[model samples]
Target: MTMRTFASMAKPGVTSALPLKEIPGSYGLPLVDSLVDRFDYFVTEGAENFFKTRIQKYKSTVLRVNMPPGPPIVSDPRVIMLLDAKTFPTLFDLTKVDKRDVLTGAYMPSTDFTGGYRTAVYQDPSEKTHGKLKAFCFEVLKMSRPRIFPEFTKAFDELSVEVEKEFENEGKASFSDKVDDLIFNFLCRALIGADPVAPGPASLGNSGPTHLKTWLAPQLAPIASSGILPKVLDELTIHTITLPFALVSRDYKKLYDFVDTRGSALLDVAQNEMGLQRDEACHDLLFHIGFNAFGGMFILFPSIVKYIAKAGQDLQREIAKEVRGAVEANGGLNMKALESMPLLRSVVYEVLRMDPPVPLQYARARKDFMVESYDAQYEIKEGELLGGYQPLATKDSHVFANAEEFVPGRFLGEEGEKLLEYVLWSNGRETDESTVDNKQCAGKDIVPMVARLLVAHLFLRYDSFAVDESSSSAIFTQLTKAS
Candidate 1:
């Protein structure tokens, strides 16, 4: 529980150096070690197996592995990965580690996506700018909270019809692709206070939602396929490569224009009320609503639906009953009704624990610090990059019984409340509060509401559902209505 500092542990002026062993891990080769191997393992073995394999091999919760080197590419060549739930809390302590170094890790593009690091995601806790931006985000979310259920309900109705049409025509509906558009439109309506579609004619090509996805996919593609571009080239030309797309790509241009026009009122609130510049406010909105919130929802909603389907009919019936009862008792699918469903909350937490969209977290040590594992303590030096693989930590056998299996009501009661801290899927600990200085997700409170609404709508409309599990995609089929 206590941190052993060098000055405190050593005699004064002697500059005592504690023998810090590199957490046991294979760096592979010179320069290009383990990067491809790690990426392949993640994609093939799945995130759970990827971390489990390494933890078993190293026999330690902490490890140092060589990643594709550079600032904007990977955090560092020798990155430390923490796997134990006991050690997970250290990753959230911003007093010891600096999050601003590379919040997105090495794959984060060097484009001015935030209008010159003006967004809360890119700022350190100590910066005044972070506080202002954080306040702006919180205020916007407060205003939008009342609208989340209604907005998401509308989107889900549209999505349900779309799915039914596809199933009627083709015998199966690709829920993965359909959910992306559904969540994107829902997030836009709730967060940006704008319509999710472009203002112009349908003949003008793809809608605003399509354009937004087209632009974001390539930027995020590097994470799955590392080493796509050399570190040196990425450093020099990332902004050059990214900036021009906005100017040249018709889809990017249309998306940008639509967001700017539709989100002008929100931007003005940030500028006039919150003290941000017009352009900075616009860019921040895009980063917050488009990238952060949209990316998380895109993966989360589908995962929730897939798991519920996999959980079988009895559990699905229970969830549907809870949703129906809550709506009837409350007179509608409001935030209060969603919050009242303990079983739904447990299901969402379990889904996040098992398959977090963002499995890895990256931070840099601001100063020399000490971290302890289940067995031993290690000294981490300044500038060293640290990572926490969430799936492994959340599923630690020491914490959860039957760690690998999905239990639908695992977190339903007061006893389950204590286990909430182990849910590290949101880029921050469940116990951690979102603040200007901390790295907890700004949308942490809203994400659950969004997920609950999606679940409520799905169960309300369909009595039971089945998924096409043969492929990686989560397609829907065999939808049955209530008897």
Candidate 2:
């Protein structure tokens, strides 16, 4: 659907000239209301339905709602929910939105989680340290560019050997553990300038992802609801309560020391050239890779596998033919090869569109401004927390033709590529470039590049693979004969 066509989908004649209305919905009573909303959010309605029910009830896309972990944990549980493509981008405007402590929306994780320093993700563009740290992150990526392909390929080769050995010995391969190890090794080698397992006092070996996960979980416990336990119990324990950083302190220190010692090269640049303190730079580096980049792929890689596996054999054969042909035609599996493989790129994009690793994005309003939804305008006051559930926004029927179905070629050609601007998984549109000035993920381009590489390598090694998600966790249930 075209932009004009989607604009027509809005309420007829609800133009920019329409008078602003008070944002709909309410926070209700203090504790009682927040508890009820938290229960409904994590237990009854689920994340999507929680917003969906409200949107239907208010008959509007933008409304006031209580985000989870109210009261003692989050000073203010109320936030302005932006649920449509039209209004969601407002959160990305750094000039108007203060991205200070809204990383997880209202609940700021203790700085103890990152060695007593706020990471780049938590800092707004307006902060001077934010620029330095963000620039350092970009430089890390730039310096690591030459290493990414080689390290990723080596790690993937090792991963493939394990997957094959498991499948040969047993009838299937459990990919999650193997994939996690691959991600940590590749990221550490590429970004940190040393192999994680190489002989050293600080060698993490295969436990790097675990260290990162342990540090990440408690900090996010206040907002995390994976349905790991029964509803009532899960709500009380996981969602409403704040998890202490003390639990992960030892593990976090291991990560801190490893980065500080092993990644001294990058830290030296941060201190000597970039004018950042070494200790602060170490914490920021660990958070950037360990939490943001490593943590991201830790969720995303499996998702890509799950989607491709569900697409069945035909899509696999098509991807295999396309990827192999592109590599052969371009003379190697490099950037040129990736560019030639439109279908491969689209498949990754489709997975991202369907299941973004980071589902929510939040920013506090900097000043009073008018926010427009698909149909109406609402006046937002300064410092009001503005958030969006991107999974719902990307699937808005107004902007996308099939919004729900996984069409592998949805982002194939020039026309198809236009749809990418609405893909906001990286804290910004895929069409937008990431720079030190914005909150866009530093590894935005690197992420999909590595993902594309992983997918390409898999098809090249095997004709196809299948997954069995029927079990408690998704696993590689089978694979066709290796090519």
Candidate 3:
């Protein structure tokens, strides 16, 4: 697999909707605010290049290169930098093209994030990029279906009870809203197993961790994405040099405190429920269901809902295929019941492929590496870094054939295995080009399991809509209806 170039994506109408990569709100936010612009460009243009393994231009942005692309390693630390003397030129040097770091402008959160919600662009060694992505897709994605409506919405719970404990009036006020209640309901059940005020599942009375997890996600978002803003960072005059850092230190300590407190309870409940007998990454029904369903899950729900809604009739039909079959035979649904639906599984996979919650990954370059096949030097020198995007890779015509068409069987049939390895979340086998193993589902055969089951149950048995990208721009509504 040679390095994929975005130019290859120019297959017909490949880049026609490429501009969507520019703004977060789809049609809004027209300017490049910061380093994120570079990533948008890569995805827009390089999306087609994902077909092969090489990275290519996705879109050309107004956010031009102020400094030439530098070693990929230096930019890796671009996450939390003090834009002082060192940061000024260092950022420039990091962007210099001379360095192995394919500096464009893509990043994934590194501070402390769970799951695969952060996005970034990475410099790559062509084929290896594909391999690394295969490993990720398998490992991260769920094996089953989503927790669909009816059952998901049925079991009632006094939602946001724990959070209500934290902010008091604030929590009550916020939770009163429909969407807020929905997010809280999904999270509460997923976390404690019982929705205290609502229904069953039994609870361990663990509110400490539950509440902390609630506030942690949004609180950390601002710092991670835009870090202490320019004014805040600049406020620290000479005398306060160590002061802000001290406050930050305190905040850091608080995070540990919160994690330890909440994580401990979660660990116990999660371990007990899963009947864990060995050391694992805490990925059981408790953690998996809780984290994605409740905990830190709200981040991407809005966008996903829109996408699903936009898919409209096609989405409904696909949902029916997965859900309908199960209802006709297996009665209702559970993890196993959802497994019967393949179309549901495939469609979910394609949805993720096109609009990954994180788009790209942020990993600093370990060292300057070369794309052995392309024979091009991709400097990953120390202090430099790179990010890899699955969107650009998945949309590549070179790999996906039609590329943009949402053909459900796009990943099915003969070449299924080949595309499977292309997913950014999974642990598939490694193989060289030519006689490469086409491990269908790219090892991410699992990620969609829960969602599949949940959706299948809804599509087949209950009444609910799909989560396509075309729903509505109001990302928040997706969260609102989960209840």
Candidate 4:
């Protein structure tokens, strides 16, 4: 019989604390909690495994999945495998069923299956149906300052002003606490939008955000100091804590009921004030994006920030060199920024190499087909796609030098064509990659442009100093300092 150990699922008005089986693959057992601990490792390693599994089985079937956080959901590799197999016209078939995953909480596959299923499909992002797969960069980035990035930066600036004023009297720990407060508000305001089209759950009217924030603050407190918690926990606590918010806000039944009553006008009010365009984007994409982006940026940004702060010897020079050269002195950064800044470009390349945000991309088998059929005359018909990460084409040692180091200038010498072509999305032919492997994050092509510009401004305008001898030591000390 199926076992039950720690089956935890969250849905509106319902909390799934059902005990799940302790087995390795069972849903919601504590082991699954490892998703929080080794997120990158799991995605990268798991993708490779899935790829190898399908290629071995010579099987084909659409496998639906539901991993949390809306993290890199569309990056599933089955789609890539299908496109790859299509070239052979006989290797296999792949289909990506972009289903509504988040609201449901559990992935009920198109069919309930038995052993060795293609299970990498996941991500419950709320978009205009599969739009998250397409729209994250363009819809979010072009918005004016103080919406996503600008808005958060503004909140941080206000918080920075307050922190600076208080620094005259506050202690070091106090300064840290204030900074955390700023981060909290910055996160909320950035994700929720400035206006109230910003529908959240029953805001507790009087004490929800505060109470939740207050309740959540301690979770990170130890992370800042005692250092007992691992790196992943410290970084991901907010996203995990915000799950309850999802449980509340997704309650359209209750929300619509309220709209039917007195809150009906809120729709128009929110639409106008929040600048929400039905044709543009949705609150779910905006909010959930915080979840996806926070993980991606924090995974690498803190380290980058520390590098900048501590590299006092050459910080300004490096910034000006990469930015002025890549963004300004050159043409300008639009999508093409994905090339240029070979040094900064390698930064992204190496980070993705070392830590793929989510190794798997979501897709399923549309039909069965064969692999090596020319020799054995056998088949892997319909649904099976290769089960694995495409590190072959992505982080291929031949394509990338050192393939191991975080060398900032690794991509510098390649000509624009070679550098642009080296990226996983642009370099490989079909049957050679996983789904999301072919693309970086949405707007990935342009992300480096924005980041380089932002970092350039910070380095040029602000004289940043190391908070301590080594930024890593600072990270270690922060484990115990924030509280």
Which of the numbered candidates is closest to the native, going by highest TM-score? 2
Query: Can you give the lDDT of residue 473 in candidate 4?
Result: 32
- Order the candidates by TM-score, highest first — what do you get? 2, 1, 3, 4
The CA lDDT of each predicted structure is 0.72, 0.86, 0.35, 0.36
Model 3 scores a TM of 0.48
Candidate 1 per-residue C-alpha lDDT over 1-483 given as tens digits, one digit per residue, 9 for 90 to 100: 223344343233443344444568876774455555444344456455666777788878888764433323543456787888877767788878887746656445555434455466766787767777777788789878777777888888888888899999998888887887687777777877666564542221336567666667556544443334654443345422334344425665555565677777777888889897777666776778777888788888888889998899999999989988998999888767888789988999899988887877888888886776777667788888888877788888999999989998988788898888888876787767787667788888778767877888888888999998775668987788665
Q: Candidate 2: global Cα-lDDT?
A: 0.86
Tens digits of lDDT, candidate 4, 1-483: 322111111122442333321111212334354353235333333444544454444432212122333222222121223212212222112222222331112222221110112111223222323333334333434342335445545645654466445544443213333433333344444433332223554332222224433322332232132244554664455323322223333332232232223322333433464454432233333222332444334444444544444445364456455655565554554334425555555555544444444333333333442232112222233443332233433554545566545555554563423543434321233224323322224445433444453454343334443445432432312111111
Off by over 4 Å in 3: 1-188, 191-296, 299-304, 372-379, 426-447, 460-483
lDDT, candidate 1, at 72: 36
* Tens-digit per-residue lDDT, 1-483, candidate 3: 222333223232332222222211111232222223323323232332322222213122111121111123122223211111111112212222122223233322232332222111222323333333333323323221243334354532333233234335342222222333455454444432335333222222334234434434332332132223443332222111212223233333433333334344544533464443212223222233333344323433343344455666566666665576676677656555666766666766666656654443333334333211111112224433433444554565545777766666555666764675554432121122211122223223333553454345334332334332332332222221222
Clashes of 4: 53
RMSD of each: 4.9, 4.3, 13.0, 14.1
| Candidate 2 residue spans exceeding 4 A from truth | 1-15
Model 1 TM-score, all chains together: 0.87
> Can you give the TM-score per candidate against the true fold?
0.87, 0.94, 0.48, 0.47
- Order the candidates by lDDT, highest first: 2, 1, 4, 3
Error of 3 at 367 (Å): 3.8
